[model samples]
Target: MNDYSKAARAADRVRIVELDAEIQELQARIRLLQLERYPCQQRLDAHRYPVLALPNEIVGEIFVHFLPLYPDTPPLTGIYSPTTLTHICSQWREIALATPKLW
Candidate 1:
């Protein structure tokens, strides 16, 4: 009976160790995915961002798409939604601000 109990505990310990190792592996994979995604995000941001000569209407359209839909307005503070729009640069801030529908 003692030996059987010891074996069961040992098995449980091994299973716990295996689960821990798998969690570590998953964490590493998540980190790897984030590293892989950062460049992709930058590329996407570049493509999405208007650094140069696109028309203001087009830029306004883009800003309009970034505003949040359902939240109650954030007061006259002039911040709008979809999060990433206002969180970006000065030019982006202006574009988001000027789009009449954004607020």
Candidate 2:
């Protein structure tokens, strides 16, 4: 009976070791998959934003709304100025420059 009990404990220890190795391997595979998915996740997240999906014409119209009232020249330095729109992103910069109304 003593020998049988000892054998059973040894088998349990071996199984524990095997399970630990499998757990480690599965964890490594999960990390690899997450790394591979990161860039795709970033692209999906970017597309999810409403403003980024707007057409250039609509974005141009939105820029037009940011302008100062007539006879009041938009400041070149402050956050409310057209120059700030140019600083937002490359697309905004191009749109702001092309819109003669803002200048």
Instruction: Give all candidates' CA lDDT scores.
Output: 0.72, 0.87
TM-score of each: 0.47, 0.54
User: Which pairs of residues clash in candidate 2, taking residues 3 or more apart in a chain or in different chains?
Assistant: none
Question: How does model 2 score by TM-score?
Answer: 0.54
- Candidate 1, residues 67-96, lDDT tens digits: the string is 555455534444554345656777767776
Residue 82 lDDT in candidate 2: 88
Lowest summed lDDT window (length 10), candidate 1 = 74-83
lDDT of 2: 0.87
**Candidate 2 lDDT, 1-103, residue by residue in tens:** 3666977999999999999999999999999999999999888867876676688788888888898888888888899888999998787898888888887
Model 1 scores a TM of 0.47
